[model samples]
Target: MVAVSQNKSIDGRLVAIGCNYEPWIALLEQSGWKTHCCYDLRTADSILEEYSPCICVVDLSNNDFSLNSISLRANKTKQVKWIAIIKKEQLKTDAIRQFINNFCVDYFTVPIPGSHLLDTIGHQLGMLDIEASSWVEITSQHDMGLFGESKSIKQLRDMVRRVAMTEVNVFLTGENGTGKELIAKSIHNLSKRKNAPFVLVNCSSLARDDEKLSLLDGTYRNEEGAPFDGTLMLDNVEELSKELQDNLLAYLQAPSCESLDEEMASDVRIVATSSADLDAAVANGDFSKELYYRLNVFHIKVPTLRERGSDIFLLAETFLTKFAREYSTMASTFSEDSKQLLLRYSWPGNVRELINQVKRAALLAEGNEVKAEHFDLPSKANLKQSLRNIKDEAEKDVLVAVLETHRGQVASAAKDLGVSRATMYRLLNKHNIVPDVRHYNNGYARE
Candidate 1:
């Protein structure tokens, strides 16, 4: 009976802000979310007061005003699930970004296939039900900084936590600069292996012949009494020569000679990264099949920046703060135009691109606010054939208009754009617009 009741409770109510009977709602309703729509604060509050919905969906289309009010209510109520629905281009805006960081529980962006969205939402609902089951009263904590609230990232994080508690091998797969190495370090930090040496080797940097031999033959402990129990991260393992692949596998298979006297045995937990498709490589007879299978024991795939939904700005701000501190730049906020641009960009280089841009902008910025002119993005002509072209232009136009409207509070600009705070920074980057540069707490721009 208890199991029956528990299983039935997965169905949840959804309070939608800024929507008007979209086909998706009908689909959601079919899947068990009792969907209700609201276009304004009054209607939203009334629905909240009446149905006590467990989830709230904020529609970004025609809904800038609702963002401010909904965030306030979500903070006050503290129990409702708030999800943001937005286009991929909107991620470049400051307002949308800011709103998500402060209030959103999750997000679904454009190009999100219907099946994927449904699966993600279903997973979120299931997780919420589990959280609600505990007897110990605890507040749920949500971190919106990583640009993803999807099931994939959630599942990956859960796996990271579980794997971190153990001593084993972890292999991460992602596009170049998708932060595979960062995730590896995160796992290392969270593990009992934190105190041990964390060695990183870039397999791609080594020549094919050099990579084939035991590169570490004399680097560390050729003699005895050397330390072990460290973390070894083989970066870009897809680049390993066939000979090297076989050599490493042979070492891994031999626990006797490889062991550093059993007691001081190689307690090294292996973490490997690959931007290329190792499976395909092995299937194509380019890489050793056995090596690929060995590394597949545990895996994590970091999503690209464009797929992270509204967390784009969160990551931008993180880079902004780090760059500002390092460069002593006065850029305090992103212009509305700048915010939109950030969301519009399809970051091919992922977080690394954002970081590089932020660093460059900080050093070259003329005022407290970084302006669109500060960034040296590709020319509109060059971007014409790019996938993000349309998104980029729309972001520029909207941000230019928003900045004209708000003068620049970052907060105000974001509010006008109907996005979260973190999103605003992305807009700035997208359009290459900078914000007013002001000395921290000094309240004044230099010139």
Candidate 2:
């Protein structure tokens, strides 16, 4: 099972502070919430430890608790999503402001709108089930940073092993920060070409034709003007200009004897990565279809950090240990609050972002443990945006799968998904996927 970060929705279980025998408690119970009431923060913390409830409600409207009492317990928000209920006048207090901003995920003034409170609670509970329920399998640890215990990562690792032994060109695709480069490198290291020089061609930087040729003629060039017998990875291959695309496709299709020069015969294996949708690019006439097909002889979709579930913590721990030793920081372990924040934040930057944030957090951490504040925890607005991204990515996956299952037929996929053709097309375009119904754009088919 996933750690606390990847658990189920709230089990209708809650700990309500300063709300003993109140009308709110009755409303919650009537709504099927198993309300556990506590008078003080200390008592509530004990209950939270025991129950591990998804939510904790602190109703300060009717209670006479001092602001200090609330501030002292703010750290208790480790894994629980805190909802504060206060009188309208308490909004002006600095302590009250800090309590809400620093601890609570949300707050409401007195005469709370019952519906909105319930909605917020429901949202938090729903977040607990994010991309977690489907994966629970664990795989053996790797010495590298691809350390994950989730089923998705295990499958990805297995695929890497399978593909590494082949001689066909590899096409790695995923979000920009999902470590496509690392995957490519891993493939190269495992392949027979491990002894040869592996070269990276940043396709985006090849703005000028001469500059592109310079990499071919410069980086891995032997004395004979031929590239070394190794792998040549085209990073961000989607950005290739039509001219470069033509040249690359010609080079890949040509036999080894048709070298750049009569004296040289190139022996490099091609591996390319694209963060953009080559199908949509091909459909929109933005990329060369021939190059896409040639590079895609073996395709691997690297799983995003969010899709890897509990691997978030695994990566974080790995980065922490590595950087702690390097940076000589005391931040060895993540505090409970930090762990929750790490899981909740959508990690748009993926593993790359996680590494930077962890390294920075470790250096900034004052004590032995890394706290949420050490990572520059997200504001309420940022958290909402991140959560929305998580939802959007999940939706995009569904759209891709449905469309693929129907052999890229938009009408059929739309009907299967119970969405209108227009809606399906809209989603397809939104996710940068184009239905496979199309004509050529000056690129040859492999058949």
Candidate 3:
């Protein structure tokens, strides 16, 4: 029998289900628990939807109770913690064991004391409150300094939340302007080591092996004379040389760096970003397979501006507002035409490019409203050669955006764009665009 407790005096919300809920209900009521009871599985969904309870107590002693039905209900209410009350003999059945493992947080035999059951319920409720509180704080305070309301952005935010709960090495792969470093900082800020230092090592920027080694090995101390702790972000990890890759591999293999004591070593976590396809690099023998696997324990692929769709306008407007405040400009909003252009144009440089364009427009606008001309967008000219050139450039921009969206995976890019791999490569060659490499690698060729 499933039932809802009518008592409104309790501080917590719970749902109870089973054949013999009379005894369980009495126990729960005595413990001052507020619960919604559902006797039938058919009505369980409605009760769950209405109350949104954090904890669920299921009585498995009923011969008519279906584990599959309970599992479905549990899946529907993923945030709800389920506690199973079953006969001791039920533990011998593999199906029951699997069901409990998959759907329930805690299980009890028929003779479970009221105190023990209440304690388990209280603990789960406490944890739920903590998680909800953390989520609120993370979302309200620009958790990772990321701005977007698109489904893709929401998924990324959720992924960031899950990743921050652990201290494993993370690999972030995205286009050059997709704010990989920002995501890394967000992870660090949300992690347990938020109070510690977040050191960024741009693998591509360092030319010398010793410089790279010192940074990775924690020999390079900060201004505070402390070794890099908290999180170490290896930006553009694919740019690291084969020698540097080997050194990094060795460092990763070592339990603790010789330069730092155990305390410092234990405090550090690694987060790496790459614009190129590291898996392909490994296949092509350009990157170490061992290091790639080691660093890819948790991978986050940031979405490109185009993939984020209308979020482009959201980001553009945000940038405009920011730059207006910073430059003391009168530009308050984009003209109708300008908004259309912002939506239509393919952003090859992603978020970074949008910020730059918005800042420039904010600085240059003579009136309160920025016009289409304010943006550095393509012109609609009558000249045939110029028109052809404009078309080619637009095509290139789209190809580059899509390629970056897929993190330089030619096959994936082709599939996304609904073009065959051969045609994709042909188009790349036609546009003289190198797939996967950052725009800076070619001296920002489009610029």
Give me the candidate number with maximum lDDT.
3
Model 2 C-alpha lDDT per residue in residues 417-446, reported as the tens digit of each score: 998999887877777765554422321112
Ranked candidates, highest TM-score first: 3, 2, 1
Q: Mind giving the per-residue lDDT tens digits that candidate 3 earns over 44-151?
A: 677777766467788886656778878888765735778888899999989889989777889999876777887787788887777767766766653254668999
Clashes of each: 51, 0, 10
10 residues in a row with least lDDT, candidate 2: 131-140
TM-score, one value per model: 0.52, 0.55, 0.70
Give the per-residue lDDT digits (tens) of candidate 1, residues 232-252: 889989888777887778767
Leading candidate by TM-score? 3
Winner by lDDT between candidate 2 and candidate 1: 2
Instruction: Give the Å shift of residue 67 in candidate 2.
Output: 75
Q: Which ten residues in a row have the lowest lDDT in candidate 1?
A: 135-144
Q: What stretches of model 3 exceed 4 Å from their correct place? A: 1-34, 37-113, 116-127, 141-145, 211-228, 255-264, 380-447
Return whichever of 2 and 3 wins on lDDT. Answer: 3
- Pick the winner on TM-score between candidates 2 and 3: 3
lDDT of residue 74 for candidate 1 = 67
What lDDT, from 0 to 1, does candidate 2 have? 0.72
